[model samples]
Target: MANADDMLKVAAERTGELAAPGMSSRPSRKVAVLACMDVRLDLYAMLGIERGQAHILRNAGGLVTDDVIRSLSASQRLLGTEEVVVIMHEHCGMNGGSDDEFSEALAADGAHPSWRLGAFTDLDATLRAGLERLRTSPELSARDRIRGFVFDPETGSLRDVESD
Candidate 1:
């Protein structure tokens, strides 16, 4: 594979114009999905939605941080999307670590991020925490249908998380 610089150049060279240029900013699914930034997770196939169907907000643990709340507020008020889906997964790297350990690790690299690392003990409980954050967030336009799921990459399926 090419180096990072070459990768961008190669990608640009092979890229084509958008086929759906006139697509609206509003999500077609009327939902916003908060998911882990794990490269293996694909929202399209998991939810069976097409491009421009849903607003996907990805972060390390898919936790509802302040930034996510900010985005979700705008997604509902400005954009035409509603509802929230939190998809955490099995074998997440966020599991089995402490915030202090994560902070110290970053400190060694001369970077001290202020945000919580959101490491957790239980995957299902972590997923539930994210779900509850959306539920309690007053700015979310449609909290009635908030859902959480734990994706099993091994089984290639999702297990529903019971509401808190």
Candidate 2:
């Protein structure tokens, strides 16, 4: 069976165990968190966030892409999120990866895209750049509170990244 099938079976076994019956769609904490899609880091447990408390967005490397900005725009404007937190982690796949290789692979498959793979060599610098992008983006309603961090999966700890 597929992994999704296994997940479905578990969901069936625990139906309503994670349900929030009366919780509002808006985040109670009025914050939005963007993080890498790393299985080792559980955002809820790491950040002490519960369901309906904050908006959590995840993607490769947790770099601030255009799509992330778009989501943040809606998160702050429509969902009332006033703070933003970005978390990239140590040993991320995107770290030390090659965008050229990724693009060439896509080209071999006869695909062409406008966006480049956000690969970075320096974790802290990348985090700082992403934080700066968030801070300068007029689309985000609350920019002053935007912060970035680098998670150490080995130690299960997060180190703050200073932005310009």
Candidate 3:
């Protein structure tokens, strides 16, 4: 696990070099990308997008949860983003995981949350479902350009997912 103090120290040291001058809050590409919070998946390099090119939203499993919808709505309506890219991946931790067991574990710790683990066995199907959800959602102002993909970290390959 990374130490917060150490991370902060490093960030403070590099803060001067990390400045992005004259970059607007709005994405230059007018797109929002929702991808897994996996350490190996470098969205900027993988998607060939720069820091100011797209709004990047990351979560476990890359599932299209309510919060993701909220962010997407804001990205499209407020941030001038018109397209969305959903990227699920091969060998995800969510694959074949048990949500009920996870919930029970949380309950054992005396912490009960309303959210599910968003686990799924099929990566392509899950991506397609998330894409469909986004496409049909009334919350997002721009749904026509939404696309989904499956990334293989081992092979460094990104494959497009077709909605069923």
Stretches of candidate 1 above 4 Å error? Answer: 1-7, 10-19
Candidate 3 off by > 4 Å: none
Candidate 1 residue lDDT tens string, 1-164 = 65999877877886564346688889987888889998889888988987788999999988889999999999888997778888888878888879998799899999988787888998887777778888898987778888898888788888789933
Could you tell me every candidate's TM-score relative to the true structure?
0.88, 0.94, 0.94
lDDT, residue 14, candidate 1: 67
**Global Cα lDDT for candidate 3:** 0.93
Q: Relative to the unseen true structure, what is the C-alpha lDDT of residue 94 in candidate 2, on a scale of 0 to 100?
A: 96
Candidate 2 lDDT over residue span 24-74, tens digit each: 999999999999998998999999999889999999999899999999999
**Candidate 3 lDDT, tens digit per residue, 61-108?**
999999999999999999999999999899999999999999999999
Choose 1 or 3, whichever is better by TM-score: 3
